[model samples]
Target: MIERVKKYIRENHMLKAGDMVAAGVSGGADSIAMLHILKCIQHDMGFELEAVHIHHGIRGEEADRDESMVRKICEEWEIPFEVYHYPVPELAKEWKLGEEETGRIVRKQAFFRERERMGFPEQKTEDQPQFLVALAHNRNDLAETMLHHLARGTGLRGLAGIRPCGDGIIRPVLCLERREIVNYLKEKGISYITDSTNLSDEYTRNRIRHHVLPAMEKEINPRAVEHMAETARMLAAADHYLLEKGSRLLSGCERKDGYLFEGEFFREDQIIQEYAVLEAFGKLAGKRKDFTALHVEQVLSVSEKGIGRYIRLPQNLYAVRQYEGVHLGKTVPRKAPESTESLVKREKYPAEDFWEIPVPGSLECPFGIFEAKIFSYKKQKIEEKKCTKWFDYDKIKNSPCVRTRRQGDFLVVNREGGRKKLNRIFIDEKIPASLRDKIPVVAAGSEILWIPGGRMNEQYKITSTTGRVLELHYQGGVLA
Candidate 1:
């Protein structure tokens, strides 16, 4: 057992010379066997070892006995030991979380606190001594986890089950079967305490262990647990490879606010697209708890819908379908205007809605500053810049206002005064729906003269008979 565990540790690079390993020993058969195995191999592996026991503040005398047994074993073996007590039941209620989840959280907190107290660096580096927390998950546990995830509906990552090593934690005895661990402990004459909770069917995992797995082993394959563990290892490898590919696909799709997934993203395999979207969601949310395959599907579904459509998500995030791609971010765009009359009749508009541009002065608005100036038309070379436009100044019927689109907003599409609604123009231009409300348009009432970075109304174009030129320059925002 020691040789097999050593091989597994080496394969996973769980330790190196001068490293410190803190093992969680709960006086159960699996953890006790793991502590013994790690103790036997620590000298040969050139690493230091210590034992940690968590008292979950439940089960009364039984819990105390478990902690006492673990401490006695550590003392006899000359291994350093530490114990942490947490009121898991009380904390569960206070935190508004399940007891199981609260227990897991406290266990992790205790392990990290021990690491910090030992003067170990939080982050591992090649040149410095590394610190790791060792767990005692066996093959049977891995199989149980896989079945649990499968029953609850999960993707590849969930199906991969318990990992041998991740995020500074190591599971050295993961390759060992439950029977092998019990037999080894018996041969060594080492006493261990079993939690009474394991005997009850109250927990879902206990029910699986007591009934589901035994039925599978009897009616189906005798080595069902071993087979499931093997399958989980394979799935873990595939998941790692796909996540790397997804990360590569997400590159260059970053926007100022969040990530953008365009048509090229959809061209990839559906699985790859899902992984990329999942990664983007995780990045923006800062965590993946409660994020499921269903959420990923919802975000992807927006791609098939019209531009400006969005799905509200957990963590106050949103995934908006843009003209070019799907944008994932925390910013929620303002609601779109239903009609021009509704907008004109509103008693008030946001400060971003309107700013009058003086004939030869500058005005600041939500999108940016607009500078207007009149100059003599001497057949000067018209610069073809998106931020700068030349219009017939004498043709202006009213002072132009820099604002967002309103109902009945139209642009002159032809020399013969043919008009195009702003909504129609946006549809023809493929502008994202969310952006239509934000794009600053130079308008004279409902007649839009110029959509900076896009087209200008034909009526405002410079002509040979024009005597004065109105040059409007935009200085900021998306268009700029």
Candidate 2:
């Protein structure tokens, strides 16, 4: 078991000399063996070590015993130990979250809290190196996880199973099985605590471990654990390869606002590209992706349309198809005040009476302004003459302020005295109800001036009699 762990550390490049390490000791055989192995190697590894235990307060006395056992083991090894108590059931109820998810959150929170509280650890003097947060998810655990993900219809990421090292967590004993860990403890004459809740059939994972695995061993194959573990190991390697390749491809096609990819990318033989986009999009959303292949199909359907279309994403973000490209951006603008009570706080204004927001650039004012320079011919091609309003360079006033629409705001929408309310125009345009609060309408008193990158009042529109044209295109929101 020790040699296998050493090999895993070396193979995965998990740790080096002179590092601070924390172990999540659950008092189970796997964690105990991991803690013991680290302790045994401490002299040669040259690293500091600490232990953290999270008491989920589920099994009452058994939970307490787990914490006590971890503290005692750490004390015997002369390593630092921290314990956290969480009311998992209460939290599960309050958050409307499953108990499993609640426990995971609480455990991770405890780990981070202890990490911060302990401060930076001193460099190892003679040990190999302390493996940071060494978790004891063994081969058997990996088999179970793979089965779980398989049962749940997971994709490549889920099939990859627990990573050896990710974001400061290390699973050092993943190369060994549970029985191997127990055997190593017995050989070393080491004792560990056991949680009785694990014997119950209430939890799905518990049932898998206690009943399903034993049944599989008897009915299917005596070496079911080994076979399943081996399959998982192979799948994890292949999944990692695909994920890395996909990430590289996705990065090349990414943009600041969102991502753009050819429809063929999704249609290609390589499904990894789509997964990579999903991974990037998930990160941009600041949340885990809940999207399935069906959702991807929906996105692909819109992308194939070859016209501008918007699909609402899970977290209020939107995926838009524009001119043979797909864009992912926040669908909803950040909510801000619509009232004019804070108008007097304004400072800088656009030069002269007309604000020339400089070509090939953006101008930041009280509201958003984003602009791009396009050739006259190209501009004519993309711009909808009806939706777009161009201003004559001479008629434009340099002094302009960007603000929300107010009462009595009127725009001469047409040459025939067809005056209309700015709010009414927005409503008629079918702008989303929630977005009305965010669109910044350029105004010069009660007269609606330019809607900036959007529709301008007919009074402000440049006609055939008008001279030179400088186009200011306005979208649904403030450009800035």
Candidate 3:
């Protein structure tokens, strides 16, 4: 098992010399086995290890015991350890999110915190971050994930299953089966804590893990899990290639009023065209989620005419096929000039349109997902792409918020910190007046930091002396 895992790590280049890997140890068998394996190999591989535990607070005393168990194990191995103590239920309720999402959020927060603990500012010259996170997802986890996505109506990315490595995280033990992990623990005579919740079928994942995969294994092929994972791996490779081709296909589209894809776009295969439009839509929105096959088919139906009227899309985005090809833009609600109420409604942001950005967290806006994380910075080269950007953390003085432009909203211009009205920005940039109200703007206090599809304020940009950098990565936005 160890040899196979080592080979997998080698093949994947999951670790590099001088990597300070923070292993998320949940005190569960999978995590423990992962930590043990990494610990055994880390020294020889010339990488440092740290163990991090997050007490989810839902399991009461058992949760505390889990933390203690993980701590003792780390201590025995002389590993540096830290515990992220968070109230999951309270956070979930306050954020208006489910327990599952809240847990994922907190875990991500814990990982970033550990990354900050590791010394030095990451070099821009480096393709990967200096510190990396290793997860314990096994073959069963991957199989369960595939089933979960399949049941929910997923796209190609979802069907690709759990990613082994990306965004500064790697799943070293993902190549190992659950049984292999258990056997490794037994062979080494290592005792580990198990979460009581895993035995319960209350959660969707729990039910799937306990019933769905096992049934597939028994009723169908005995090697279903292995075969499914292998299939996912192959699909992931194909998806990557398709996305690259789709990007090239979508290059001709203009984002101002809406995407204007030339007739050349429709020349691709129908399957390729579906993915191509999906990518284009995602780029315009700054992130597209819950986008299903139905959405794709709806857009396709209109384009089949080679000329169609405006087709309203979900999330206020709209599409139209014309002599100029296809145009994807935000749907602007027309109002009567005679109606006073209509004029008033157009002047302000809707109550539901704005959401607060959590400190060191993520928020969902109409544009897409903006994940904010802070890290101490000593500037190396910062490659600013269209979708992702970074800012000087200390410059943001208030809780960040995401919403459509409001009256008097402005972005800072010039080194003097002079202000420019957002409306003026729109006009200056030749942005269509119709699309201004629909564009997503991220404001830190009174200052507008980023207009996702538009311009970012230069005054708040990260500098060499900046102590901390705020990474604002937007998913579903224009990508470079």
Q: Using lDDT as the measure, which candidate wins?
A: 1
Worst 10 residues of 1 by lDDT: 339-348
Candidates in order have lDDT scores of 0.82, 0.65, 0.75
User: How does model 3 score by TM-score?
Assistant: 0.67
> What 10-residue stretch in candidate 3 is worst by lDDT?
336-345
User: Per-prediction TM-score, please?
Assistant: 0.69, 0.64, 0.67
lDDT of 2: 0.65
Residue 442 alpha-carbon offset, candidate 1, angstroms = 50
Per-residue C-alpha lDDT of model 3 across residues 35-139, encoded as one tens digit per residue: 998988987888889999998888898998999999999999999999999888888767754566789999998887777776635443355436888899999
Q: Which regions of candidate 2 fall more than 4 Å away from where they truly are?
A: 120-131, 263-270, 332-480
Q: How would you order the candidates by lDDT, starting with the best?
A: 1, 3, 2
Output the better candidate (2/3) by TM-score. Answer: 3
Error of 3 at 173 (Å): 0.8
